[model samples]
Target chain A: MSDEPVRRQVTLANPNGLHLSPISALVKEAMNHEAELLISFDGNIANAKSTMELMLLGATCGAVLSVEATGVDAEVAAEAAVRLLSEP
Target chain B: MQVRSGIPVSPGVVVGPTLVLGSENFRIPRKFVSRDVVESEMVRFHNALDKVCQDIEDHEILVGEQLGSQYAAIFSAHLQMARDPRMVGQVEDAIRNQSNSPEYAVSRTLRKFAEQMQNLGNQYLAERALDIFDLEKRLLRELLGESREELSNLTEPVVILAHDLTPGETAMLNTDYVLGFATEVGGHTSHTAILAGALEIPAVVGLGRCLAGVSGGETVILDGDHGQVVIDPDEATMERFRTSQARNIRVSERLATLETLESETLDGQRVQIFGNIEFPQEVEQCVKRGADGVGLYRTEFLYLGGNKEPTESDHYEAYKQVLSTCGDRPVVIRTLDIGADKVPARIRDRFAESQNPMLGLRSIRLSLQSTPLFKVQLRAILRAAVHGNVRIMFPLVSSLLEFRQAKMILMDVMEDLEDENIEFARDIPIGMMVEVPSAVMLIEEFAREVDFFSIGTNDLIQYTLACDRSDPSVANLYRSGDPSILRMIQAVLKAGEQYGKPVTVCGQMSSDPRFVPLLLGLGLRQISATPHSIPRLKEVVRNISIPEAERIATHACSLDLARDVEHYLLGELGRLCPDLVV
Candidate 1:
């Protein structure tokens, strides 16, 4: 288990960013990990495992957000979030 | 997964999609549940959640099949949001602590979250917030649909689940689309129940608690025979339902084959079997059943439920519908016979309240008193008479003078139409209902002036035996097979025989297969009963010879007590067709 939060900055390459599908996909992926996942954009932070909260971030095309994960699977959880959000 | 027990008012098994009708606009019927129902309400809430989750899963599969799996991912999000502890937790807390009804708890919790999403003020996000509102509608539809007020706009065939139905609402139901109906609160004789029987729609009523666990559009199994409503029945129950339905269809097909058969005895004595209908829509039922004609088209319904007297067109169109449906077949229209208490609301107070409304100013007496209202219906019957064979009969004519006076009013209406030179059947046959004891006592004198005689056995037995038929305690005394009733019917038949006019027995007794042979033996060449009973009555009529029926009636009439007569008649019917007695 990691004590320090693993963080990565990612830009959404997909044309529709943090929209209904992507936000839902991120939540589904984030729920797979035993870690606390958070995605922050424009000073608005949302729990990566919550679809409504993640959607409320309202990130648009090419929007840059920070993905942070902390727990046993922090590394893979952050990597999954970054990879899912960066999908074109 | 929800089941409700109600009184099955109409007999049939209905497995179809449901359209629930009740309170709308998140207007919870009861905002709060009592402490006792709180646990039940909470359980009800979970059931709704489970139902909604299954629906979202179904959409996922369907959408995934049509488009790619990614396109179906949105429903997955909805599924998650529905189970989200934040939403469902709050809903449960409200139901548990505040005693809110499950419907109210869900509405409050979801609306709060939906409003939060909407208030975010981002165009893209606000539009996506519609997903939340859609989810809310899904939950409500799982519990119950919108109001009964929206029922008129139904464009598809669906069963109805409702809290209750008013007489007007039940009367106006379209038999074409509304396959069956069940209600949360109502008795065996409620409007929904009686009208369901009259309209031949499967129905269950008096479900003490319902609609809370159901949302609209679910496949419902309304077992009107057992008065059970099972929502989302298991595969096993559905399999049983299908097998029984197949057997029922076989029986129906056999009866349907009888549709084209004649109502004749082995000796070839022909009888005319007509339908007694309350609504014009039932004329199609009569035609399908091969009824001779509509022998009793009850016209009081046009007035009873409404605030004002039915306009001339309302009366005309209904008669026109029935007559045109019958084509050249005779359609007998009974004029307004509603008791003064049951008259249209506008003129209801005008008549003095009678102590015993049944014996009071009712039927021909009420019509004679309210000539203006009575004349409107008579004119319509005359105008629509040109459409097909239309005979006008006055209901509950207790005296010859009352019969003649009703004729005088009919003649007056005829003259008014004549002076205006409007088109109508000038020679429409006029008759009196042989229902009251006096009507039978003076049958010969009254039989001469009237063109025909139809023994209305229901009221005749009620008045003859001096018992209220609806009173359960005295139900035995209100026997239809009472000796006095048979003798009265015999007298009417004899009068018709002497006057050379046709006579038809039109009542519940005529519909009973047990009474069919007895009626035939009493020399009733024709009868009119509800459309539902005509098929079986025809089957019974076909199986028995006139001589057999004559023997049954003679033996029944010779019996000492009403009990002996009824017992003997049932034995005779059982002997005729072992399947019918049970």
Candidate 2:
């Protein structure tokens, strides 16, 4: 298991932007991972698994966000975060 | 009777008993707990969260059954928030360390999240703050052992009035019991407004502090047609509402007959009535309303809402949607025309902030500056042209040189597509929006180069008078019926005549029934307007002969004052279509 966190950059693709539906779905996906995940966007950082915090990021459609995860499953968590956020 | 005005997002008339939802913020009872009770308070907080989650799940099922799964997604969001681990941790921590009551901790934690969301500076994200507050309210109700006044439980017919509605609450509003709704605070773009429209529930929003004066069970008249809500109306207003309701039904019944008919004059001259739409979804409405085709599909929506600059495929998909819907009908796809300030921050960061964004690097200027971005849209439009009749129209092209530059990029994109052997429609007729004064003045030069001309009367009126369109003080001067606007359209029309190309008035001027006569009188054979205005324009179009329209135009053009020009045209329209029900 790696001590250092893995990171991936993802941009929001939903036309309605980071409204509740996407935030809720993203939070649910992030919670699925065993790794500790964090999402950073426009100087705002939030626990990726926290629906409230992720929503607080206020990422609109096309916002480039940095996703970080740490644990043995950090790489897998980062991949999942990227896939969820970047899908059009 | 108190007359309240708001931005109408849905269309209907309803008179019903008002069900005003007062503030959900109840008294917390107490703020703190004894240190010895902290462990018990944490347990109570978790229990309330569990109960709130159950309430949310119940709503998910009810909303899913009533309003479809798309709207039910709101509850799913709420459910996730209720079960949020960090949020739960925060509430539990407040109880364990701070010795706060479960109710106090829940209120404090959720309010902090809600306030943070509201101040996020993004409109969509800000609206989601209501969902947090909704969750807080639900949890509070559970913790307090209080009954909730859920709209899904309504039995009698009533109009739901509220301070503000969460998307989840708005979604579950049973149309069977909920005749219509209004709110003290909400914009036309708010989820309440959007859901109201989706539910076909007549709604008025952003009525300010008017709700505090009225009580529940008061007789309310919500006229979404006029964006008005009348409480305790006078006899005259009541009579008028009854007549207006009858008139609304009559007007639609009258307009419904013209759906399949061509917009032809009494003299048998065919005028093309096209739809000007922002979204691809609106294309169906335009088609359903018998628009000859899409005259102006504003492509800025693709760039404006999203964080990323739309890919070629993004543009291609949007164009394909519009073109596929239009089928063989000519669909003139207007390329990106929004200003930089309106785009996402990433794009906005690229442009130097200007005092006046309207006159700044926007439309063709922004496109020319970023040929890569411009080429992506052009390539997509060309590729989508293969789907159906597609014409690429450049917006706000102020100069022949600017128009040439845009054309060169389009030509370049075409060459690239050809080199790559990507299938694309080559014979796409390229046009420029004849909005800018310089473009109108150089119509003769532009006529020699471009395929068609669309007189963007909104910008033309604004630019011709140098009156900011958004400025209320100058709004009176920003008339589409201005003599200068008519003269410019005439010049463009004359040029179109010489060039043997179609010149359409695709601005707000074309959609207006009063100006329809003047525009037709000025020899515009095509009118592209929003779908809602199509049937009325078509009624006016079919009623008058080209000779009559020409006479009206000549009289209107002769008038010095815009008011006189508009008044004369309105009078003529009334005479032409005496039964102008639409």
CAPRI level of candidate 1? acceptable
- List candidate 2 segments past 4 Å from native: A1-88, B4-236
RMSD of 2: 19.0
The candidate scoring highest on TM-score is 1
Number of the top candidate by lDDT? 1
lDDT of 2 by residue, A1-88 (tens): 5789898887789877776777777887887788999999989888987888888877778989998999978998899888888877
What TM-score would each prediction reach against the true structure?
A: 0.62, 0.60
Supply DockQ values for each candidate. Answer: 0.26, 0.51
Model 2: per-residue Cα lDDT over B429-544, one tens digit each: 99989889999898999999999999887678878989764343444566777787778889999999998988998765676688888888778888898687788889998888
Q: lDDT by residue for model 1 over B1-582, one digit each (tens)?
A: 668877666778888777767544233344577999888888878898999999899999999999988878878988878867557878899889998777667765765566566667777777766677677777866765544226666667788888777667788788788889988776553335567889788898877645645545567898987789998898999998998888777767777888998889888999999998888988998999999999998886787676666799999999899888899999989998776334555666766766777778777888898899899989999999999999999998877778889899989998999999999998888887888898788888887788998888767887899876344355447777778888989988988999898999887678778899998998888989879878788888888998889888888989879888888988887887665543
lDDT, candidate 1, equals 0.80
